[model samples]
Target: MSEHKPYTYVTASIHEGVTRFDVSFCTSEMSAKAFGGDGERPFLTLSSTEAHMTVTTTGGGPVTEQDVTLAREIFTASARYLANCERLHAEQPVNPTDQTTPSGEVAA
Candidate 1:
């Protein structure tokens, strides 16, 4: 509930991909490597080339090990949960969005 406790989150939609991150309560901008949105994988993964963390918070360098660790844990856990949900979803049969006819056309 603190006005300046430390940070916040950003959900951005990129063409052909997605970018999600945590930003400290700063007037400037920042970026970070996040997981849980890679379409190829049911979940997400982070690595040196796969992802990165960028901070442009006007003199906000030296990101701590704890910060990166925390973000990794959070995103990984989320991805795991999503994978489980997708598994469950796949078990169900696909339902027709609307009634169909023998001609493979929508029925009135």
Candidate 2:
């Protein structure tokens, strides 16, 4: 059997209402030989706001010698995240459609 190489992946974590994520890109040993480091390296990141209402990506550009579908991967992950957000929002007990305040005044 041929030796296995690590595959690119993404991970997520939540802390203090903030969701932090990381994207790891796999670097082949051959690429490492031609380039420098091998294995998985952080390629991108996504983070959530304090209110857990928004998610933003914060990271530098990827520096690598290998050719990979970086854009597709990122877009796929983002789409999944948005879908999950929508699902969770739908599952919330509080109705977001209700805009009336306790004083019976319409929230502006």
Candidate 3:
């Protein structure tokens, strides 16, 4: 088996020493223009609007079993990571005044 090259699908530019991220999912837009007519559909689409990423499998052969397994693993890992982040944030103080600084100073 050959090692697959790492590809960067998304990027963010830093400004004012801060890289802010606005997390949001695309509200699935469906129209007649979208593909799907049940004939010879040949490509797998993996899209993430938040990251502005749209990856598609293009080739003569179909995706291998390993590819499906890897995709499932990726989905599981991503879901877990998002859940963990939400859980951590949910545990934070609800009020800004309840927040504290690194020096044990409470926010005013």
Candidate 4:
């Protein structure tokens, strides 16, 4: 069996109308517990957020939006793969019609 039982994942949480999330890429057991919130890779928060989107990384990391989607195929593929792997309990229905898919390059 793999060591990482829970597996690395992304999580979305909403509080006071703010939609927050964390993307965990770390796999080490010791490291995972230490961070308490998805290791030190980076934490993301997207506020409710009709059309405007501002990307913020916790710990004030210098990650730019450019790094968010370096490769369309790769990014979309990753999102698809994680959607199945991540232990998510989504509050919102998975909208298959969401034009926000990276493959489209634009959200309708």
lDDT of 2 at 45: 32
Tens-digit lDDT track of model 2 for 21-104: 865544332121122236433433322222111222223335333324554675798799779978655554453477654445
Stretches of model 3 off by over 4 angstroms after superposition: 1-51, 58-61, 99-108
TM-score of 2: 0.29
CA RMSD per model (angstroms): 16.3, 18.5, 14.2, 17.9
* Candidate ordering by lDDT (highest first): 3, 2, 1, 4
Measured with C-alpha atoms, the lDDT of residue 84 in candidate 1 is 90
Models 1 onward score TM values of 0.31, 0.29, 0.40, 0.22
Q: In candidate 1, what are the lDDT values of residues 17-108, reduced to their tens digit?
A: 66555422332233334333343212222323223334222244444566567657877986997799786555533444545544454544
lDDT of 3 by residue, 1-108 (tens): 254543324446689999965434433431112232365433334444334432223343455676567557867987997799786666655555568644455544
Question: What's the true lDDT of residue 99 in model 4?
Answer: 38
Task: Give one digit per residue, the lDDT tens place, for model 4 in 1-108.
Answer: 234454456678999999997765444332211111434444333222122123334335654565455334545876887786553323222454553433433343
Pick the TM-score winner.
Answer: 3
Native RMSD of candidate 4 (Å): 17.9
User: Which regions in candidate 4 have their CA more than 4 angstroms from the true location?
Assistant: 27-108
Question: In terms of lDDT, which candidate is strongest?
Answer: 3
lDDT of prediction 1: 0.45
